[model samples]
Target: MSEGNHSSVTEFILTGFPGLHPEYYGLTSAVLFFVYFLTVVGNATVLFLFATNRSLHKPMYYIILNLSVCDILFSTTTLPKIISKYWFHSGAISFTACFIQMYFVHCLGTVNSFILFLMALDRYMAICHPLRYPNVLTNSTILILSISAWTIASALCSRLVIVAYPLPYCASNIINHCYCDHIGITMLACTDRAPYGFPAFLTAMVTLLGPLAFIIFSYICIIVAVSKTAHSQGCLKSLSTCSTQLIIISLYYLPRCFVYLASNVGITFNADVRIVVIMLYSLAPPMINPLIYCLRAKDMRESFLKQFRRITIPKKGQVSALKKS
Candidate 1:
């Protein structure tokens, strides 16, 4: 594994969940397929409702739409290959495809963090600065913010990929994770990986923690403002909104923080246990987000019910014709 004898890796064999028992591969693949199905259906329902309903064309719904799209992209990027690996025993991935997956995985993740932060900001504006909320979060403003999130996330992730790609991956080509990622792939490099690893780690922390800090601050201000309101109903309503956002935020960040701490502080966890934790944090949010965020909204719930009825209910003429027949 000397630097002088370094050779480029062409493909990688993904050892997804090495601790998973071979006897349970079928069961695990089925469960993953079910989760992936739910993720797609839930997020797609949210996106379709937003796209087709003129009533949901507001700034808040627009942000939710963006979030739904991100969930779909994230789930698509990570889940299918793992499912294929478990079900069909197909785990070989080309070097180019691995890096491509790594790029989108981190890129979408960064985008999601910023989107959640933006959501908190939107709520803060609506509650604390109601008079200026409309002007502050106009369509144009939201568009610019969303674009900035994608652009900045892509740029930072691109740098990480660029730094990691050219390094000599002369050692083992087996990635011990479900998919390609900065840490999982970079660690396979033959030479001193400190130069690449440190920057990638730093970037990951900033991407995850920076938005998290802003989200926390935003919620604090929101809670303070809501507490100062005279009406108890308004306070309850505001608290309810903030609570949902906080739950989603906690689900997304807490497990990630735990993993980082455990890995860095020498806290040992079984390989399967660690992978399960990662999957839960990464996949659970996307699967349940539509329920937490969209279904929780009174208007959205009502609209969805109404839409469902429209699709299921028969026309008056058709009902009469059926009765006559």
Candidate 2:
């Protein structure tokens, strides 16, 4: 059979997990539901906090909101369907649906990496060039930059949707993962090389390595600049910003390298290992980003807590009054 003429696999069997007995479905379903629910609620609260708190009307929080949005999209790309399939025992998705999932997963993932890079750059500018910082990263400029990030990400990932869609799908449709992943779906391709291999590598590098290098380099410059400053408070403040960003960047970037970049080298292809790595790379960032910034950053914590108290104290008093009456 010629490479092109080889009847293309219509779908893939997702090896989501080792087969669970029917009895455990209830327990697994409950657990997945709770996890997805909490993820949604946590990300939604961060977005809401970023929006309503006027004190948070700064570049840092704006970047955070962007991160939260990306995280929500990131989680949605796979987790929801994965949860459904395992829980229901009928987690079948069409060829079209899988391609769409693969596209957005990469697109949002690329945007997330870019957003983090921008966040690092913003910190660097704020510390290294204080007076000019406001002028340089103005609201208009951030808006333009954020738009540019998304546009570039979309353009980069557009190839996946274009290439994956045209291939003929046949009887083999079981996707090993709960949702459509590039690595998982690409394994099933008849052409074997073009539909999945080259584009995936190119996009992974653009999405993962490029942004990580920028973030690390930006921080290096910021650290040097901060050391030169004579002002104690300025130095401390700069360190604080860099520290928060460093923590998040380290956590997010490493897993991405392990999952996407390392996978390219054709390491041991264990499905379970792949899922765990993907979860860390995908789910952990959004989950911890708000925690890092809100809990660790003093001003953000104070602002978030103060706002929470302001909104909640009145309701508490009203509840007490109602109980007394």
Superposition error at 250 for model 1 (Å): 0.6
TM-score of each: 0.94, 0.87
- Top TM-score prediction, candidate number: 1
In candidate 1, which residue ranges exceed 4 Å CA deviation? 1-8, 261-268, 315-320
Find the candidate with the highest lDDT and give its number: 1
Tens-digit lDDT track of model 1 for 108-169:
99999999989988998998899999999998888899999999999999998888877887
What's the residue-level lDDT of 115 in candidate 2? 95
- Clashes per model (N, Cα, C within 3 A): 0, 17
- Model 1 lDDT, full chain set: 0.87
What TM-score does model 2 achieve against the real structure?
A: 0.87
